[model samples]
Target chain A: MKTLNENAQSVGTILLEIGALLMSSGASTNRTRITMERIARGLGYGIELLITQRALMLTIIEKDQQHFFSRLKRISPHGANFRIVSGISHLSWNVMEQDWTIAQISEEVQRLKALPHYPRLVVLGMVGLAGAGFCRIFGGGYIEMTVAFVATVAGLFVRQEATKAKFNPYLCIFFAAFAASLIAGTAEYLKIGTEPDKALATSVLFLVPGIPLINSVTDLMDGNIQNGMVRAMNGLMIAFSIAMGLLSVKMILNF
Target chain B: MIFLEIITKSFWAGIAAMGFAVLFNVPRRAILSIGMLGAVGGLIKFTVMNFDIGIIFASFLGATAIGIISIQMAHMRNSPPLVFSIPSVIPMVPGMFAYKMMLGLIALTSIENTDDYLQSLISTVNNGAKAMFILISLGTGVAIPMLLSRKESIKKSKFNKKKEVTV
Candidate 1:
């Protein structure tokens, strides 16, 4: 006989495990949407809204004097069971896909149990260092700025493709270049009292754009609390990756 | 030597900038054009600012010109300006400037010196205001044309609307 608190904790842990599995199994964003819809329906939430980035937001609509809020609260602790990994895949120009596959979805949950996020940090760090070194040898004010600009554009274009070889490298280079250029140049201008290497390391280290942060904040401001918090958390994780990369570089370079 | 270095840097920067712009959803045709324009704008702005041009005025002009050029590129391809403007202008994001201003404010505000505090507050406000102004101006410049185009599109589709009305 577990207490409500213990049940809630178990639910939260399980939901996280499931989400991780879905993410690892490479389950498409459409599956997540369907699962969320089913959950909302099961919870007696009559209103459903889909936002950009395939975010599933549910609104409880009730007629009569029924206490719907109470019902929602009772159901929310178990809502994690409903989160599905889903997104709209753009197959080609003017061709979009929203296919759902539930069997492999569980694999994603299982995959989450065996992976570490630190490798991503290391990879990002290597990319950043390579970008910095290239820019140091070949970049200046305009060059540095353009690298980031181009990278952002690249990221946007290739976002739909899951395969890294298809588009990630070009985008990474662009992102890294602009960040490195700015970090190096600004350090020279501000005279921030630290050694040049240290200044560059700290400055460009956080240049990774917190796209999720901006998106989450906008979603929260628009009153989508659940979706907003999710995005914000994801953004925080990305920010952490950038921090780890920067710290690693600084330590290695002895800056 | 400097010329060679500048060229090499500019080439890589242009490629990287364009690559990013394209990756981020900017149309492929406009990627290099916008990036090169940005590189040129930055170079032009930096050069002009050294000779007493106000930083605000310089940055504003650079961004505006880039915006206009991106819009023109969009028009040439029979596409909307939304795609080009976002990617083309991304190179000029003032994140570093904004961060520095924040850091300066924290340091100054924390110190006991009244004069330092005043200067930090002023710098923070100035940077913030400048950043806001750039965004607003960019928005306004793009929005005006988009609105006009949408209206024109509606007017052209009057026949479809009439058919719907009758149905």
Candidate 2:
């Protein structure tokens, strides 16, 4: 038997949980707010939410009633996983159209979060192919593309290992970039290919922070200045770390 | 000959987008479509650039195509358009320019002479601004399609309201 207070607390906690999941899974602030609001409304509550880069502030009040709960959840850091973003979106629509218990929603959230990633070999192979494709787009020859492929694979392997070891996130990117450019720069040093410099340039691109840069602009345009700036700074810092890695290789190889 | 070139380049572009889609953990069901959309975007950008368009403008055109298509696709799939559009635009990202910008900045630190310094500054600014503008164009282009459709829907709803009033 749940008291009204217990119900209210549960609802508030679920909203916070959903909000945290959205924020940490690369959703824009506006989307997170809208999704949380939609779910809260479906549960007969009104919500006021404030989103920051590292945390969310939320208040849930019962509809046409005085009962309300407020809490804040700190998001560890965002890692982009659009699959979760899409799953939550679909769930929100379902909630809007059909009645769902708090427990059911919690179960679904766990399911979505537990979705498996692509196999490691497949990911590594495909990204390597992407690197070679990038080399081709940049007018590199087959030798250059091959060199880019190998370099990119090696670099990504380093990044994956660093991340698995729970190293700092930016440090992982730096290490990956350093490994990639070092491999590519060797081609430049040995004068092995027609466009080794281009290969070197393109091989480090897997760490470009594409989603963050785009989302930063999207957030800015949507008037989420705080989150936008945070995301922009985040993207720029990652790019800078990559640059630092490349600089290290360039200074070492004079390429 | 040009057709084959476009096909080849766009094919690689699709592969690039697929890789990124996987990287971002876009849903499994949507990966192929994301790749197709990315190839189409590459085709558009490459074709536009052939007509003497700048890279920034070409990329905007490509991104707008992605935005409109992805938004419509979202209705059919019951998911947000961002999931589709973000990876689709990966092929058009200015990664090379960003790398060049970084290289230029590095060169600036080594400052050999006035001429060398100026060259480094120019290279850095040129590549950096180009990268920034390309990214901006892509973001705005993707947004424009959604904005345009919203207005259309509003107008249709207003027209429906008028009909109801007349009845």
Best by DockQ: 2
Q: Chain A only: TM-score of every candidate?
A: 0.32, 0.95
| Cα misplacement distance, residue A140 of candidate 1 (Å) | 5.7
Q: Residue by residue across A53-150, what tens digits does model 2's lDDT show?
A: 88888887775567768898888874678888888887776676676778878899899989998898888998898899888877788999999999
* lDDT of candidate 1 over A109-136, digit per residue (tens): 4553333322333334333332332343
Name the lDDT value of residue B82 in candidate 2.
83
Q: What DockQ would you assign to candidate 1? A: 0.09
Give the Cα lDDT of each candidate.
0.39, 0.83
Give lDDT tens digits, candidate 1, residues B56-82: 665556555655555555445433333
User: Measured by TM-score, how close is model 2 to the native structure?
Assistant: 0.93
Error of 1 at A43 (Å): 30
In candidate 1, position A80 carries an lDDT of 14
> Interface RMSD of every candidate?
10.4, 5.1
Query: How far is each candidate from the true structure, as Cα RMSD in Å?
Result: 12.8, 4.3
TM-score of each candidate? Answer: 0.42, 0.93
